[model samples]
Target: MRIVVCVKQVPGTHDAKIDPETKRIIREGIKVVINPFDTYAIEAAVQIKEEIGGEVIVLSMGPSRAITVLREGITVGADRGILLSDRAFGGSDTWATSYALSRAIETIGDVDLVICGKQAIDGDTAQVGPGIAAHLSWPQATYVMDIADINSGSLTARRMHEDGWDLCAVKLPAVITVVKDINQPRVPTLKGRLAAEKQEIPIWKAADIGADPERLGLNGSPTRVVKTNPPQGRMKKSVVLDGPVEQSVRRLVQELRQRSLV
Candidate 1:
């Protein structure tokens, strides 16, 4: 099986700033790391490869500096890494990004499965994975908590939801976005790190992937970020109840009633 795991380089800090002019994250000079959720996706792919014997290829789309995340994946068991980087790929929204990635997958060919994180922390739209599926006309299962079974033909996975999870089966050549509940990521070995450091990751440009120029970047993106604002700070208040247990319980009930809380 040829499994492709989609990874991303994200700002390591929670205090990432947004570019007021572009309405995008200001990534310059920020310490970067692999997307936290994507780590679970990588772990899932590596586990599947270990069980069934296959190649695990880590793919990412970002600037040349983003190669760090690709090499990071290799240190954990990905067989190889591919990067999509070019000026034309700049300013791509989820739709354009997924389209480019889908094109790259087509270029890779013979891919049996594509695995991705439920969402990127920086963007958090959670649309790219499903968008890739839509572009490829393949089945997709998102918010996957576990993979029960997988082979060349199909896979059975548990999908997570608000209430709980449900099992779903999808044919091969499908896409799935995994949640952190799927697995704990393994630490990289010294030897693996050395290998990753020496590995040669090929960079693919937009033309290399045959992505339509009309749908390549900012101009190609249909959606626009009109505005951005920092999240409102929440207020916190606490009261202490000291008395007999019954008395405290009654007091708590009265307090809740006063606040219109059941």
Candidate 2:
């Protein structure tokens, strides 16, 4: 089993600003951190590798600074890391982003599984994982909560839905987007950190991945953000009434009814 975990470097602060022209989050100068949700994916990949006796590789696409997140993955038990970075790869939306990653994965050769977080906090679309699967033409399971079984190049898992979870079975070479409920991510160990420091991560560009220029970066993305603004803040406050418990409940219900909250 050769498992590849897809990770991302995202803005660490909530105060990240957006580019008015592009309507994309302004990344320059913002502190970058590994997407928190992706840590669970990483953890799941490591566990799968440990159980199945295979290698785990972490892959990410971003600016040169994104290498930090790849190295961080190595420190958390990934065997190696790959960074797909180039100026031409900038301003990629989920569609183009997945295309780039899919190409990179192809360049890496044999892979049994791909794991990713359910979504990135900065962009809550939750589209990249499935998009990559589409590009790779592989089966995908999103919002996966647990891996029930893995054997003979097949996987059985539980996928979370609005009402309940559904059991799904997929062949090998599949993509899975995991939620935080999947597992608790572990901290990097001393040895893992040292190994990560000594590791030399390879960076790939569009040419390296044999990507079509017309299908990558901002130009390839069909969807564009036309406008962005912070949601207006609420100004109302709750009032406590001094009365019997039942009376308080009645008052609260009446207030809710008046406001159509129910």
Candidate 3:
């Protein structure tokens, strides 16, 4: 089994500034960290590798600084890391980002499984993983909570739904987006950290992965953010009442009736 986990480097703070001109988050000078949800995805992939006796490869696409996230993954047991970095990849939306990642996966040759987090915290758009599956024309399961079983060519997983979870079986070479309920991420050991420091992470560009220029970067994105602003704050006030239990109940009911809340 050769499992690939897709990780992302996201702004560590909620107060990250957005570029008004481009309508994208300004990444430079912002504190960066691995997307919190992606840690579960990495945990799931590492667990699968341990059970099946295979290698786990971590893949990330971002600016040159994003290499830190890849190295962090290596420290946590990923056998290898691949960084897709280039100026041309700037301002890519989910669609173009997935297209580029799909191309890179193809370049990596054979892969048994792909896993990713349900969403990135910065964007809060859970689209990239499914987008990658669409580009690869493979089966995908989103919001996965558990891997029930896996063999040589097939896997059974528990997918989270609104009501509960559904068990689904998929062939090898499938993609899955995992939620934080999957598993707890392991801490990097001393040996793993040393190994990661010495590892040479291969970098790829749009051309290296054979991605079409017309289908990559901002130009290829079908959606665009025209503008963004902080949400308005609520200004409503609440009233406090003190009286006997029955009087208090009556007052509450009167307030509800006054506000048409019941």
Instruction: Please give each candidate's TM-score.
Output: 0.92, 0.94, 0.92
Q: For residues 1-262, could you state the per-residue lDDT of candidate 1 as single tens digits?
A: 9999999999986669889999988777888889999999999999999999999999999989999999999999999999999989888999999999999999999999999999999899999999999999999999999999998899999999999989999998999999999999999999999999999999999999988999988977998999999788766666788889999999999998998998
Residue 170 displacement in candidate 1 (angstroms): 1.1
| Backbone clashes in model 3, listed as residue pairs | none
Query: Per-residue lDDT tens digits of candidate 2, residues 95-171?
Result: 99999999988998998899999999889889999999999999999999999998758999999999999999999
TM-score: which candidate is best?
A: 2
**Model 1: colliding residue pairs:** none
Ranking 1 against 2 by TM-score, winner: 2
lDDT of each: 0.94, 0.91, 0.91
By TM-score, is 2 or 3 better? 2
Where does candidate 2 have its weakest 10-residue lDDT segment? 229-238
RMSD of each: 2.1, 1.8, 2.2
Question: Candidate 3, which ten residues in sequence have the lowest lDDT sum?
Answer: 233-242
Error of 3 at 29 (Å): 0.4
